[model samples]
Target chain A: MITFKNVTKEYPPKTHALAGVSFRIEAGEFVSITGQSGSGKSTVAKMIFAEEMPTSGHIHIGDWDISNIRHSDIPVLRRQIGVVFQDFKLLPKKTAFENVAFALEVAGESTKRIREVVPHVLKIVGLGEKGGRYPRQLSGGEQQRVSIARALVHRPKIIVADEPTGNLDAITAREIIELFTRINDFGTTVVLVTHDRDIVNGLHRRVITLRDGKVSSDAEKGKYLLS
Target chain B: MRSFFRIIRFALQSMMRNFWLSFVTVSVFVLTLVTVNAVIVLNVLANASVKSVEGRVQVTVYFTSDASESTVKNVQSYLLGLSQVKDVSYVTADEALAQFKENHQNDPVILASLDEVDGNPLGQALKIRAYNAGDFPFVLQALETPEYKPFIKDKNYNNYESALRVLSDFSEKVRLGFLILALFFGFIATLIVFNTIRVAIYVHRDEIGIMKLVGANDWFVRGPFLFESICYAFIATVVMGVLLSAFLTFANPAIVAFFQGVDVDLVSYYLTNALPMFGAQFGILALLGLGTTTFAMRRYLRV
Candidate 1:
């Protein structure tokens, strides 16, 4: 579960990235946050990972209030909540399996455990056969799948993806979204942030749209409401 | 312990992946160390040369020919008793006359003048050697006592004293020049290492970000880079050690032959001090590399 209660984040000279935003999603939910370029949806995703702190109010992921989390605790929070970025963010020098295993390695997992779990997760993302391929050798969708596999390696409780399909073609994008759906079906909470209208309309899931740093709409089955 | 091995593995992998960069960094480290060792070699040779020249300089005290043999012997005993005086050899008047004739044998006018003088006119002399050339003045001044002054003919220490001063000054200047050269090389080495790390970090900027985003702690991200810098230091030191041994093997015989009588044995000197000398060089280089790596990481590696 994730909750943001009246959180406000501001930049220098009164540029408000988020203005008094409040939202909550229960466990095992698949949620899409939709917005224009500067609607603060990305900021919301960043806050979930504690990459950005709120200027006022608070953010709580389960029982952890990360509004004033210590610097040393950020990694712990990040490990609990996996983050996927628009760029895929795979280490270019590493193969798909190594990239996935990197997550567990940082967590000090055993080699035997990594060898077992990395292949399993890569298979879940449909990269089992391509585990040895480096990021440069993979297609756009394949790279995104690798990124997802990495996020899933820790079996994180929540997955926050910010524009993960932004660089993919329509077919590949849909495949990635379906992969997220499959992951959610396994009881992992998925929060997808995007501006693509068709992907949102097709999902027909809970949607929270932001406008001018404020939430404009929230519906259990929402469509892309902005032009 | 597992993490430690993983860090080392990652460092080796990174180095191999960036082979040319690693090569350049280590090469620069070796160059810096070569300059440092050159200064050391120059210092050793300079000290040896100075000591050789100092050994040849001694004060000769000439006593009048009529001065008794007992009196000259007493003077030698007195000079030898001082801690600063290393040795004093008494030359009889007859031996002095013979040495004078031998030295002037090629000069007909000097030999004729020496033959015309009353039989064996040269005086008994005492050659006084001191532990340090600077102590000659004190030794010479000691002879001015009234008991010995009446029989004394001449003392020749002032000439050698001026020559020693000039030699000392030149040696000091040479040492100072090499020091400046070494420092300049060290500065260039620091800059190159700093830039090398910065460039390597830039090349891996995306990887570093990915690692951090994937939940790597600060040490986990920094470990490989710090280890890589240490590897460069270790490799460069080993390479330098091999190169110096080869150089000494080829150059020692020629050096000994050139300074024939000067007792300059570079091979032996290096052999005796190799462990401490190389150990100190490695320590300094490792410290420098670590410092530069930390600074570069702080500037460019946000994680």
Candidate 2:
């Protein structure tokens, strides 16, 4: 349920981050957006999160025009979409459980709801045993799983992982991809943004490749071709 | 009610988590409140003492000793008839001479000089008390009238007028000084509160940002800070009240003995008689604390 209709994003001084890009991600779809550095993959994810508004096009997320979302309403939009960053931006002071619970708390979830939903999401990401551990205490994969658990707390309609495994080892990156696959199987729309060709090739899902700020190829069950 | 307790519990936990910062904030607020309360208390005491002094002072008019007793009696009757006069007492020249001797008993030279004066030169004097300290001018106006000029003693007027002028000037100075002190302390108190809140804001910056992200309304975020400020001021006010009461309790007897001949007792008079007035002062201070804290936190909490 994500649509970017002819979105053209231009930075100042003739720098076009995304030029005339059009794409639609249906609900329950698992998709990978692949582009090399400066190819605007991250910009696409940021637009979906309303972190950056498109310069000249409409963005619709499930019937909501998020293009003009006010700063105050950003948090509300964020609750509807689960976001995972490569750096795993978890508060270091909190345990894995607290980090996930914080998302629910910020959403004003009841204590009962938080207690019930937090452990369930943590278990879904295979972090059930690491709930009590702090971010530093967990492995990189485990930490990313905690971030995934946080994203799932509100049963968000879309899960956008922007280069989530960029800093992890290949094995850990594959493990994170597997977790995302499992989450996508449960009916949540998953959009994975990455530049790693090996990982993109392994995921035989829809691939949208960007080249010089334009969509170069949109193919079902695609391969990474960046020449 | 449960939500309120939750908010308070969260605040206390955060405050305890940052104990050193909270203590600093509380101490600052207390210091400011103490100065403000001290000024208020001093103002109250000064006003009370002025009223007491005003109640004791009267205008005394001396008659010419060579004048007939009938003329002196007429003057006394005339003073009694005036609406401004509360009471009048006539002291004959013989009695006045005896009182003068008794007053100068410690000074033999003064006593001998007074005794050597021919035939008790002191005249019959009428001491007149007025309804209010301000009404003294009205009585003076009556005495200076042309009708009463024949019986007036110019020297008596000259002596008593200077005393009256000095008393009036002292009361006005005391009043002006009290007001200035109160205003100065009030401004300092407000600044102290403002700085204290700013420091607390710096310490809890993260919590505040997180609280805002969690959909907390502006009031919910402000409530705890407001509560903290009031707590500091209220505790200081109570402590100052107790210490002041104890001080007045133990020192009252000495004060009463010192001013025994005066019309009012300073300490006991306030403790027993002006308790309600003191309570009002406390209430005003509590409100001042609230107001100052609220004002200080305004810019810091605008988010």
Candidate 3:
């Protein structure tokens, strides 16, 4: 579960990225946060992972207030919440298998366990046979799948993806969305932040749309409402 | 312990992946060490030359022909008792006469003069050497007592003092010059190493961010770069050791022949001090590398 109450972020010289936005999502829910450019959608996703702290107000994830997280605690919080970025963020020198295994290695997992779990997670993201391929050798869709496999390696409770499909074609983007749906079915909360109207309208899932740093609409089965 | 091995493995992998960068870094380290060792060799040779010159400077005292042998022996004993005196050799009147004839054998006029002289006209002499060249004046001054002055014909200390002073000054200047050169090279080496680490961190900037995103701690991110610096130091030291051995082997004989009996055995000096010398070089270079690595990481590596 994630909750934000009266969160506001401001930059220098009168720029507000977020203004008094409040939202709550229960466990095991798939929610799409939709908005056009400059809608603070990515800012919301960064806040969930504690990459950026709220300039004002509080944020809570499962009863733990991360409004002012300590520097040392950020890694622990990040390990609990897997983040997927549009660029995929895979190490260029590492193969798909090594990239997935890196997440477990940082957690100090045993070699035997890594050999076991990395292959299993790569298979889940449809990258089982392409584990030895480097990121440069993989297609854009394949690279995004590798990123998802890395996020799932720790079996995190929540997956926060900020525009993960932004770099892929329409078919690949839809496939990525379906993968997120499959991951959500396994009881992982998915927060997909995007501005793509076709993807959001096709999902017919719970949608929270932001306008001018405020939530403009929240619907149980929302469609894309932006022009 | 497992994580430590893993860090080392990762460092080796990174170094090998960027082979040209690693090569350049180690080459710079070796160049710096070569300059340092050149300074050391110069210092050793200068010290040997100064010592050889000091060994040749002694004071000879000539007594009058009328001085008794017993009085000359007493003077020798007194001079020997001084702590500054390393050795004192006495030449009796007859031995001095014989040595004088042997020296003038090649000159007809000197030989004829020596033959016409009265029986054993040459006086007894004492050749005195001091542990330090500067202490010779004090040793010669000790012989100016009333009992010894009447028989003392001449002292040669004044002839060597000025020359010794010039030699000492020249050696000191040489040492100071080499020291300054060494320091300049050390500064340049530091800058090169600092920039090398910065470039390495810049190249890995994206990888570092990805590591942090995947939940790596700060040490996990920093360990590989620190280990890589130590690797550069170690490889450079080993290469310098090989190069020094080759240089000494090729240059020692020529250096000895050039100095011509000046007791300049560079090979022996380096052989005796190889362990401590090389160990200290490696230790200092590794410390420098580690310090610069830490500084670069703090400035460039956000994690």
TM-score of each: 0.91, 0.77, 0.91
lDDT of each: 0.89, 0.76, 0.88
Residue pair clashes in candidate 3:
none
> B221-288, model 1: which lDDT tens digit per residue?
89998898889889998999999989989998998888768888888898899899988988888899
Q: Per-residue error at B283 for model 1, in Å?
A: 2.6
RMSD per model, one decimal: 2.7, 5.1, 2.7
Q: Give the DockQ (2 decimals) of all models.
A: 0.69, 0.21, 0.67
**Using lDDT as the measure, which candidate wins?**
1
Ranking by lDDT: 1, 3, 2
Give the higher-TM-score candidate: 1 or 2. 1
lDDT of 2 by residue, A136-164 (tens): 99988899999889888878889999999
Model 3 CA deviation exceeding 4 Å by range? B93-121, B258-264
Interface RMSD of each: 0.9, 4.2, 1.1
What TM-score does the predicted chain A of each candidate obtain versus native chain A? 0.99, 0.97, 0.98
Best by DockQ: 1
Clashing pairs in 1: none
The C-alpha stretches of model 1 lying farther than 4 A from their native spots are B64-71, B101-123, B141-152
Clashing residue pairs, backbone N/CA/C < 3 A, model 2: none
